[model samples]
Target: MTIGAGGGSRSNSRSSRTNKYSTSKLRNSQHGSGAAGGGSALGGQPLNGPSMGPGKGDIKHRFEIIRKLGSGTYGKVSLAYDHKNEREVAVKLIKKSAIENKQDLVRIRREIRIMSALKHPNIIQIFEVFENRDKIILVMEYASGGELYDYVSTYGSLPEPEARRIFRQITSAVLYCHK
Candidate 1:
């Protein structure tokens, strides 16, 4: 998907909201989370609907899930605390099916490689990659502030000077990448 205005407005809107449909309705619906089927396009079991929180799942062993941050075709993301480090991290759980095919595997590996190599202030850090029977969890730096899109959306277009500052930062980051 093309990254729009920085925060993935369209895709995130559908994935982030918890009130799209009631929990029971989501569980019962065809695209519901509990449907006994192959799985969702992104690899999540199903829309299991709005959850109070992550249940007692196997993930607890590795990271303590703080809250559900977002979800996508791939899987859900949670603000989790790394028990080992005593710090918060964003865990992206991509289902096996999402990266099961050979092509996807290659892409995933390439993305991981690129992320591992990059070190810039503007970029998020990838801490680790964890795999399980049905999922791939990406441990990433947790950025406390909401995405840039939220700022623009809330305040309308940014002031010219403010936009210029952001542009300079992005340019510097690109230059660093070229180095």
Candidate 2:
């Protein structure tokens, strides 16, 4: 991800404020066959490999889809149970057709690569990625803690200490990414 430079200075002060977080480049990497690697890819565990995880036809067989968490133009996210590990996971389903152009596809692939490479506790963990003819499935760590929006809406505002703690964690994750 390449950060873009902001526009030139404008006569008006109001137009001077530019978005600092603008991505200019999106790079894609080839993920061979969407197959899981045997060793470290499985989180250092010795298992049946990626085959043990859910695939196209046997997705429901391996993982019990609890319910739909949310949906967007890409696809829907569902809460699923990993029958093999007996753990809940969030499955992000992205339709192949939803990606209109090569750029969009590259962006998605780049996102997958970034998620797979990052290993920070504060960030969501992506366990495995599955792709078939029609959809791409991202098996991710289930976040039991409710959404921040919901929490803030319900509680109005967080206490100073708690807010600081959360801010610290967010900054730490951002620092790790920068590193």
- The residue pairs found clashing in candidate 1 are 33-46, 33-47, 33-48, 42-73
Please report the TM-score between candidate 1 and the true structure: 0.62
Predicted candidate 2, C-alpha RMSD: 17.2
In candidate 1 the C-alpha lDDT for residue 66 amounts to 54
Distance (Å) between predicted and true CA of 96, model 2? 1.6
lDDT of each: 0.52, 0.55
The numbered model that scores best in lDDT is 2
Candidate 2 structure quality by residue, lDDT tens digits, 1-179: 11111311111122221232122211112211222211112222211213334323345345555566677898877765665555666777777788899899878878887878888767777777766556677877766554556656777988998677667767877999999
Q: Which ten residues in a row have the lowest lDDT in candidate 2?
A: 2-11
Q: What is the TM-score of each candidate against the true structure?
A: 0.62, 0.67
Clashing pairs in 2: none
Best by TM-score: 2
Tell me model 2's lDDT, rounded to 2 decimals. Answer: 0.55
